[model samples]
Target: MRLFLLAAIAVLSTLRVAMADSAIGFKQTELPADAGGHALTISLWYPAAPLGKTETVGENAAFYGLEVQPDAPFLTGSRPLVLMSHGFGGSWRNLNWIAGALVRQGFVVAAPDHKGESFTEADATEIVPLWERPRDISRTLTALLDHDDLAGGIDRGRIAVIGHSLGGWTAMELAGARYSADLALKDCNRAKLPPQCKAPRLLGKVGIVGDGKADPRLAMDWRDARIRAVVALDLGPAAGFLPETLQQVEVPVLVLAAGVETPEIAAIKADSDYIARHLPGATTVYREIPDASHFSFMQICKPNGEKIVEELSPGEGFVCRDGGGRDRAALHAQISEAILDFLKVDMR
Candidate 1:
């Protein structure tokens, strides 16, 4: 019996090594100037022939990175495409962990760094006007479908989107949720303003309101019909979304909110619930992750990551924090499982 048990353990170890040998393919590409004249940097992760040397990608002193075969040949046959959007002030690396999980499940994930909102750059003009966010994803899809190497491997019919924070708002817009500057201003004017509305803006701006009716860009429809499914992670500025547009969304949406609520921010009920109420009951699903925080959706941090982050940039170490003592990897696994299950139902 002891010999048999030892043999079984050896076999399992070999299987694990085999699985690790098959690595995800990762590469970075640049897109031409978008409509707003901003160059977009995109990161793609997909199934590739297991041939190249595996190296750690997206790693920094503060965060752990995923081991992938960089620039490997694309795997044969078409596969589903998933576009990811990072939160404000974040880059494509924020969703790197989730991208790897999806790629392991036979998916092609593309994430673009929004011009001004990205970590590399910050411009009030581009950041203030949120309508441009959805357009970025749309342009990314169009460009990829005609690309030299990836266009043939993308299953355009099974395209979906995953976004966190402001990215979540972007996904909503792409899912047909229209923005209303007037509504947003009204919410900002209330006795208790939303955290985003209360925060000081760059360029000496106080709030997002400035002649809401006259500013046509504030209410433009930025919906992308090609997006079949959407997964929004703790989206904000929910008050700005027009109820009628939410009800009109034809694409399926899976809204996952953080279980732990922050005091300074509005409750999840006000944001996720408000949007869920207006969405078509048959197509929308809202789920809250227990013991997870807004930043929990980001990439996993290394041991002593918070200390390193604080040393580098004080008061910003909160990026490495999560609800309670929950393991970030466990949280990420749960989140990825939920997303894959949800997409499986809709991405058919």
Candidate 2:
């Protein structure tokens, strides 16, 4: 009887491990570009049974891609495809926690390291040409959806996008479906910068053409892409085009704001509120995670990081001024669940 009890316990543990392992399969590939011989590294996370193969790709490449852990489990074939983009100076790995959680819930997540940005401080100044990065995303999607390996694995008709900071801005622009020139001009004036901006102007440009549209560029068309939903997290101050351009967005949007008390936070709120009020066919939801800082959503927080311990205390990760004694995993889980829930209603 003792031997039988022990055998049963061992079997249960093994089954649990096997169940977890069956959910996800991870792989990395370098996607070649047509222009200037440039290439982008893309990481693909997909649904798989416990018996699927798992391989490790080492060392997180900040400006490139990182492999998803082989042991992660994903619900098989019930979920849709999600494409994620990282914030400025963030590598594809910065959002691993979010990606991993999404995969576990059955999403096939594809994250690309933008052409020029990554995790290191040295690459901090290397912002990819604004429009170029979004184009990269579009192309990457084309590749993923068309690839032999992933062809039928994803539900192309039900796709969603999530971005952080700059990436958030990209997601918003993609959903707006069209651009407006007047909106760009207003963003420049708000920043108190001169109008009639030229190329590479970070402050006053009407679209992504110049310095990446702090004024918000509305000078182009979006080619009527089929993205069904968008979520932007912790985006910066208005560029000229956001207000006018946002009105053109035809799908639902959710904006998550951080650091409400700070000047930057205030600016972001203003922009977010403006979009919520004006965007057509858009239902916007805004929430603030108290004491959370700009970088809290990413994996940059140290053990005693200011934003980590105080604002989010007793929730996720260490204790600090932002929040104390917060569990990072729990916070991430909430974020992942929120995203999944949003997609379920909006993407369907």
TM for every model, in the order presented, reads 0.87, 0.70
* lDDT digits (tens) for residues 1-348 of candidate 1: 122111345653553454454569999988878457567788989877798589988899999999989898876666678999888778888999999997777778999888766545646235635666787899889888888485337877778999988899899989888877667656556787665456535211312444434256646788888888899988776877889999999888889988877653446546877788899988888998878888899999888899998998787787777788578998998899889778766521
Worst 10 residues of 2 by lDDT: 58-67
Q: By TM-score, how accurate is candidate 1?
A: 0.87
RMSD of each: 7.2, 9.7
**Structural RMSD, model 2:** 9.7
- Number of clashing residue pairs, candidate 1: 0
Number of the predicted model whose lDDT against the real structure is largest:
1
In model 1, which runs have C-alpha deviations exceeding 4 angstroms? 1-22, 34-36, 121-128, 200-207, 210-214, 263-269
